[model samples]
Target: MPHCLMCTRYNRKCPGPIDAPLLFVDTSSYPSGKKPRAKKPSPPATSFDVARRFEDGRGIHGSGNLSEEMAMVWSVDISPRHVWGDAFFQNLVAFFCAEGRHVLGAVRRTPSWLHALPRMAATPPPSAARNSSVVRANEALGLALRATSAAFSSLETRSTSLLHHAYGLYGDSLRSQGRVLQERGDKGENLYMVMTSIMLSMFESVVATTGEGFASHNIACAKMIDKALEQASTGPAKGRGNNPGAGGPSPMIVNVFFHVRIQLCFVYLTTSDDRIRNDPIMDRVLLEACGWEKRRLPLNMQIITPFARLMKLQSHADYEQLAMPPTEFEHEKADFVKAKEEVDELCADICDSCPRSCYNIAYPPFSTFPKIKLNVFGFFSCQQYCTSARDGQFHHARYVSDLSRAKFVVAALL
Candidate 1:
């Protein structure tokens, strides 16, 4: 199968900071037994930009404006202000915001909307009682954010030293998180802790090719998440945690949690792991927590939900088929066929819609952008405006990877 060359998601090679030229390979042009002509070599794509080191102006693949690129990736077209600090901390902050270079353009990947990452990274926790959960929480979260930023830098720069630094910080974060868990014991049901684990998993995903790191982090946090959700849903406040004076984490926490939950469930739905293949508990929590099954869900979610449900059901049926009676096995097999047909028809109707809804408006040749959007998603021309073409094709490529992931899921089910 022909996979995209511009993205780095799920271990696809990141084409650094270069643009996928308007040139597309058409194998059909060659007639049967016709000799193909060798084409003239073109100029090298300046390693396209992903993240940049301020002051030094060093980039991994290359460097370019991130603000406008961020705007284009978003559905609402929102952008962040240009980061101005020259300090290391400030660079980390800037990189955190720009890590979309690594994430490409998946909006839910980092949850950086409205400066969430900058705020989360820049705000140093205040001094509290020694060994207090507050102090440990601050250290773990603060360091995790820093490590995540470093991981982005490592990818952009392809620097082993930077990756080592990121790993060291990652170690610190783990230790701090362990302290929190140890100090609190069973009472360590913390939203911050969960968030920390997510970031750590993200760091591992970026730096490590094997999925083991990501899986480990998530599995460790699973019981904590389950317990927290149970408390939140059943607590007197309903949808709030049980701590008094703490009312609960903000609605923002819950909302981001909901999206990430769905995204991760979607992530594992296609995983090779048998223990978590379309986890039924996670599927149930996702539906109950966010209502992604409703008709009003986003276009992507609407198309994906049915298959998610189907895949979960199929995985279950496949696992139990040996013990199941012939009648029950046959019934599920019929249901699978019907579900697959319904999903195929549903996608066929909106097949044109995802392509029709968006297009790329190329910037001038002499402008800041190095390239223009011609994001070819196999069959359609949806622009993945992660950053300017002149900068890097991170967003465009990441979006492609996301599509590939979707294909993986659908393909498995079909």
Candidate 2:
């Protein structure tokens, strides 16, 4: 496979930053089936302005400016030392930039656009060397996916604990208006904000830690929810033995969001292409590492089955305005409870079965856990941006309650 030496960026100023060159070594100038005669190098001036002179045209893919067919070939053409080493790749890029080495031009432009991009010329049977290159490329994909999967598992555990704590505190405030901060709306809105914040942080981390090709914001969100139950095993919250406001924890709300996030992640992963999504080892790893297959809702379609129903219900409730047609809030709440329990059980199984090496919930570490703040800014932000209100007139004033006796449940298992 040939590797693309240059990656074309979408630039408005010049058509491209680099160019592909066309060179011809006449067949008559060399001996047939014998030692070929050396040809003189292209002039330095020709090479010097390669990027500027090359014709800038769309590749066969139409969408990508560069030829998608060159994905494998370009990678192969580039030295592995440069591919694997940051310093080497940086220096190599700089050297290429300085010399203005452009892409080798199309061998011959066939009548059809399909033949415009580069392809392997007819060659003899494959050798050991050819097989080794393929093995290395696949190996790189495996390592990147493996790290991404592991990181997601870690985030799941942390985020789940955060959801549980948020709901637990909300319940306490609801029961006795005087318990915790004297505001119900404030507490509920804050809880929602924290959950959203946790999700954002988890997704941001995925983009940061996973290498370029394999990283995705959605994948990180799914992993955070699927692995949340693991945090429960760490232990219960402290100073709760004598605290009357320490309400019994409810997994209902946490489970709803957790499952929703997980399903979304799986959908994106299923549709992803072979470079990142089509890793041969991913399904096996998911099965053994997380017991995903047994619990998953069949093909990707099954995963969204619940959401399909939810959307329908929301439509009937919000749009139809029909009498006795829409599902009641209690019924919707009950279904959410059922889904939450299932997710909880599945998460527990994953935690129990996961290998010590494969699973690391302690990632992001205790130090990275977000600090809880009770300022008015939290309330305003939640109402203004995080939660949807019935109108600008609607307010979350119920969250403002007394915290004197309310027990502080650590937001997450960490």
What is the C-alpha lDDT profile of model 2 across 242-341, one tens digit per residue? Answer: 2211322234324333334433334333333444343322322232222222343232222233322222222323223233322354455544343334
Candidate 1: tens digits of C-alpha lDDT, residues 63-172: 56557658565333211122222222455444433332322222222334423544654554554554477677767876787677667766676767666767877899
Off by over 4 Å in 1: 1-110, 117-127, 219-226, 239-249, 278-280, 286-304, 313-328, 331-414
Residue 144's lDDT in candidate 2: 28
Output the number of the lDDT-best candidate.
Answer: 1
Best by TM-score: 1
lDDT of 1: 0.50
Least well predicted 10-residue stretch by lDDT in candidate 2: 405-414
- TM-score of model 1 vs. true structure: 0.49
